[model samples]
Target: MSKRLFTTQIKLLESNPNIEHVSERAISYKPEFKLHAVQAYKSGRAPMQIFLEAGFSCYR
Candidate 1:
C-alpha cells in the first residue's frame, strides 16, 4: 500500500470500535491477504469495509 493510504488505514483501524473490541489473536491476515485489503481500501472502500468484505472474523 502507498504510505499515505497505509497511514490513513492505520488511523481508521485505531479509531474503529470493532478493532478496539477484538483481540490480536482474531486478526491473523497473511501478507498477501493484507495487500488485497489495502488494495480494496485504496479503491474508495472504507477501511472497515475491506475487513467485512474479505470475511475476516475479527471484523465483527
Candidate 2:
C-alpha cells in the first residue's frame, strides 16, 4: 500500500477509543512484512511468531 493509505489507516485506528496504545511504535511494521503480521493477528497466533514471520529483526 502507499504511504498515504497506510498513514490514513493508522490515523483512523488511532482515533478509535477501542484501539488503545495505537502509537507509531505499536503499529510500526515494514511494508514488506505487514501482510504476514496481519495474517498472524487474524489467526490468533503468538506475537513473537507473528513478528518473526513478518521478518522483523527485533520483536521484543
Candidate 3:
C-alpha cells in the first residue's frame, strides 16, 4: 500500500523553494535540490538533516 500526504503536509511542502510540485500523494523536488541533496549525502550529512535543511519537516 502507498501512503498519502495530508493536506497540511502538502501545504508545508509546497511552500519550500526546493519543491517543484506537491500533491496529495506525490512530491516533486527540483533538479538542483536533488543534486545538492546527493552532494550533502556524500559529504556525510545525515538524511534527516538534509531534508530539514531543504525545508522539509519530520512531522507525520
Candidate 4:
C-alpha cells in the first residue's frame, strides 16, 4: 500500500470509537498480514472486507 493511504487508514482506525485501540503490539506480529490487508484495499477491495477475510484465514 502507498504510505499515504496506509497513514489514512491508521488515522481512521485510531479515531474510531468502535475500534477501541489501534496499538502497534496488537498488529505487530502480523506485518505480512497487515501488508496484505493494505494491498487488498489499495487494489480496490474494502479494508474491512479484506481484513475479515484475512483474519479468518489466519485463524484457520
> Which model scores highest in lDDT?
3
Which candidate model has the greater TM-score, 2 or 3?
Answer: 3
**With candidate 2 superimposed using the best TM-score fit, by how many Å does residue 14's alpha carbon deviate from the native?**
27
lDDT of each: 0.53, 0.52, 0.86, 0.51
Off by over 4 Å in 2: 1-28, 54-60
Cα-based RMSD of the predictions, in order?
10.1, 11.8, 1.4, 10.6
Candidate 3 Cα errors over 4 Å, as ranges: none
User: Deviation in angstroms for 12 in model 2?
Assistant: 32
Clashing residue pairs for model 2? none
Range of the 10 consecutive residues with the lowest summed lDDT in candidate 4: 1-10
lDDT of 1 by residue, 1-60 (tens): 222333324544545443432233333345676787778878899877777665533522
Better of 3 and 4 by TM-score: 3
Steric overlap count per candidate = 0, 0, 0, 0
The lowest-lDDT stretch of 10 consecutive residues in candidate 1 is: 18-27
lDDT of 2 by residue, 1-60 (tens): 323333435665554433443454356434545565577688898877764554433422
Tell me the spans in candidate 1 whose CA falls farther than 4 Å from its real position. 1-26, 57-60
| Superposition error at 15 for model 2 (Å) | 33
Ranking the candidates on TM-score from highest down gives: 3, 1, 4, 2
Query: Which has the higher lDDT value, candidate number 2 or candidate number 4?
Result: 2
* Candidate 2 minimal-lDDT segment of 10 residues: 51-60
Candidate 1 vs candidate 3: the lDDT winner is 3
TM-score of each: 0.44, 0.34, 0.83, 0.41
